[model samples]
Target: MPETVLIVEDEFFIAMDLQLMLEGYGWRVMGPVGTVKDALLLLETELPSVALLDVNLGRELVTPVAEYLKAHDVPFAVATAYDRPEQYGGEVLAGVPNAGKPTDERRLMAALMQLTGR
Candidate 1:
């Protein structure tokens, strides 16, 4: 079975494009949810095999959502433009795989595949 991937990004067009891309690659795509609230709400009932998370959601940070995913043992990659670990709570996110903003489909898919051991 293809792996299921949850995507949490605030940018509307990017999110939709990612969804389509993942679907095209035969992976089941879940929410391109734009906020921590919505992403958390979706996490309440559905756990994707892996997740692609944006570090910032509008004015809010996605640390809480990342924490939740960690606790659940859900593998995830950070997708962001920022390079500072301080931007993500002082190295808490250091060494985590990053998909980077304006995501390169090849890199993103490779990161997710590595995380999922697929």
Candidate 2:
């Protein structure tokens, strides 16, 4: 079965583009969800194989969602426009992979592929 990927990005266009790209590669995309609350709500019902998390969700950070995913053993890649992760103040994200926004499909795919061993 194709793995499902939850997308937690605040930007609508970027999320939609990512959904299309992942779907094109035969992935089941769970969401292009814009907020941490909505993403967490979905998480309560569905467990995705992996997640693509944007560092910032408007004024909020994705650190809490990342923590939930980590505790559940769900792999995730951080997608962000920021060059430095220190600005986010999450030590848990220290060694996690990054997918960098305006995301490059190759890098994103590669990161997810590596995470899932696909």
Candidate 3:
């Protein structure tokens, strides 16, 4: 099966662009959604080989989403503007690596590759 990815970013263009990028690499993407709620719902139905999560989903936090992935042993990485470890509630590396915003093709792909170890 093709590798699947769950995207938890809140920006439309970013998500769309990421989808295109991942698709180009032959990855199946589950979401590029704008809300934490939407991401959670998608998780209930399916799982990806890796996840790309943003730290903030509008007013809500993405920590719970990160927490969920860790609990399930599903590998994931984070992309956020906030660089400090505290901003992520000190969860960086628990399962999520820090991939900042304005992410490029190589950086995002490298992070995803690390998370998948593929």
Candidate 4:
């Protein structure tokens, strides 16, 4: 089976673009979900091989969701428009892989491929 990827970006257009791009490469895209609460709910049943996480989910930070993924050993990468991760203060995000927002699709695909070894 193809590697499954969960997209946790909050922006509708951005997330949709990512999802479409991943799907184009034959990856199974799980979500383009837009909040901490929704991410958690998605986590309840959908466990993907890799996750693309947005640091800020609308108003809520993704630190909690990161913690959940970490505990479960599900590899994830943070995608954010922010430069300094220190500003977020999420314990779970320390040393985790990340990609900047407004990132190119090929680069994002490469990151996800590296994470999933595909």
Best by TM-score: 2
Lowest lDDT 10-mer window, candidate 1?
Answer: 85-94
Q: Write the per-residue lDDT of candidate 1 for residues 1-118, one digit (tens) a residue.
A: 8888989999999999889989999989889899999999999999999998888888988888888888899988888887764366335566678887888889888878779777
The list of candidate 3 runs beyond 4 A from truth reads: 88-95
lDDT of 3 by residue, 1-118 (tens): 7899999888899989989999999999998887878888988998778898877777877877777777888898877767674444555445456667988888888898888777
Per-model tally of clashing residue pairs: 0, 0, 0, 0
What lDDT score goes with residue 115 in model 3?
A: 85
Please report how far candidate 3 places residue 60 from its true position, in Å.
1.0
Clashing pairs in 4: none
Better of 2 and 4 by lDDT: 2
Model 1 ranges with Cα > 4 A deviation: 89-92
* Candidate 4, superposed: residue stretches over 4 Å from native: none
Instruction: Give the CA lDDT, 0 to 100, for residue 36 in model 1.
Output: 94
Q: Rank the candidates by TM-score, best first.
A: 2, 1, 4, 3
Candidates 2 and 3, the one with greater lDDT: 2
What is the model-wide C-alpha lDDT for candidate 4? Answer: 0.82
lDDT of each: 0.85, 0.88, 0.81, 0.82
Q: Where does the lowest 10-residue lDDT sum fall in candidate 2?
A: 84-93
Tell me the deviation in Å of residue 53 in model 2: 0.3
> Ten-residue segment with the worst summed lDDT in candidate 3?
85-94
